[model samples]
Target: MNKWLQVSFVILTFALSGQAYTDDSKVSLPDDSIYHLDSEWVTQDEQTINIQSLSGKQQMVSLIYTHCMHTCPTIVATMQNIEKKLPQDVLDNTEFVLVSLTPASDTAKVLKDFAEKRKLNQDRWTLLTGDPQDIRSLAMALNIRYKKSDDNEVAHSNVFTLLDEQGRIVFQEVGDINKVDETVARIVSQ
Candidate 1:
């Protein structure tokens, strides 16, 4: 067969294969990427998505609960501080992810209310809740520890982690979130 006919046959075969050949090349995630987790998460907007869906941009993440009245608030404030300190371009590409430590109670509706109450702009922020096990798995991956009390209060560590586009932790603050804005800014700027 002629070269032109051979190329046409291959193209038609791929077209008939549907979405399989739509992409030119498949991008592989790193071994350490959290995006590899096969867990379903529900966003405040009520959309179901996997961690892999958040893979394309840098992420600033913290684990907090809607009912927390102590260090959680301070941790969120520190996250906001870092968010505000980043350059406009960096901020544009960076997303702030707040994962619920109490998924059993932090449903989509509760998360929405918390977001609205705190004036978290949906464009730059995402609030997520998932199965209890999925939440725990993610928390473990981030090295965030949490335990529920008799009063339904969760005592968790204060952690602010920066994840690069590949979903690998770039920078993390375990207990102290003070005076780390500059470091977070510098890392996410690239």
Candidate 2:
């Protein structure tokens, strides 16, 4: 009975951890179902950018406000971690975009200051804040929901969408601070 109990314990452990060599495949997003960036966006840097602008580059899109005290910081940290983990080729071909949903609050100066404060590479990163209506429309199209809370706070989704060179969302991840490296790697491989 003791030997049988040991065997069961081992089986349970494997089941709980998922078999290490079970030939299980990772579930990837379909090419056709991805949400594509279709419209032109005005950047916080006073530049107009279109979806086709990223035709040859992979992009990671996330919704964040510079004023956010909690999750937004985590999102920024996660993005930095992903940037750090990418290979040189991936880093060269990829761009990180942060679209501010709080357009009424985060202005160009604010975004510029925030980017500088974070020491983000301006060439590889874009933090955008523009027309509130446009931001809302884009957020809805991307399926990124956000609502303003009390006193300059917001309750928002912590999702990051990785888009391919053709502007197709290849992967979606939530709570990126912990899984950012894996998410970036998965998208980079495709």
Candidate 3:
């Protein structure tokens, strides 16, 4: 091939790849809708972590507890699958976070253990457990609802929210946890 044609082809390839690698969920959100964090959040680590701290980066947000026997696991598994599907370049820029709604049941030790079992990247994934009231505050802000059972089981929404780089909510899915892949693709591509 001629040198000019070869260089042109390489540049075109890089541009196309970069476009393909981005998460485009921002385009999916209603044009008038805004994405913003409701309040500063404190973690069970006794460390303060404001949702605004996540600004300028794409993020996947979900609610779960370490002790759950069923739906929670499915939620986590779906999240892991989403991570796997994402390109490495996008994955590095994106963060996956799980908020422990059952603060009492999800201690730091338990969250650490769960992270270890799942082989999740400590830097990339955050398992947060704070006061139940704080959890409720955050949940309400995210439009997530849940109830505690007498037997220690908790029933919560199976929803996941994808926030764009600007901290605006892009997509919210409420149903089978398996749909995370497609929902996330919309965010990453935006």
Scored by lDDT, the top model is 1
lDDT of 3 by residue, 72-117 (tens): 8888888888888888888878898888877777777778888889
Evaluated against the true structure, the overall lDDT of model 1 is 0.82
Give lDDT per model, in order.
0.82, 0.76, 0.74
Runs in model 2 deviating more than 4 A are 1-38
Candidate 1 C-alpha lDDT tens digits along 1-190: 9999999999888878774452221247777888767689999999998887887889989999998888887777777777777878788888999999888899999999999998887998999999989888898888888998888899887887889988998878753557656666566656
- TM-score of decoy 3: 0.72
Least accurate 10 contiguous residues by lDDT in model 1: 19-28
**Predicted model with the maximum TM-score:** 1
Which scores higher on lDDT, 1 or 2?
Answer: 1
Query: Over the stretch 162-186, how does candidate 2's per-residue lDDT look in tens digits?
Result: 7776667677788557797677668
Q: Of the candidates numbered 2 and 3, which has the greater TM-score value?
A: 2
Off by over 4 Å in 3: 1-46, 174-177
The residue-level lDDT of candidate 2 at 55 comes to 55
Q: Per model, state how many residue pairs clash.
A: 0, 0, 14
**Using lDDT as the measure, what is the rank order of every candidate, best first?**
1, 2, 3
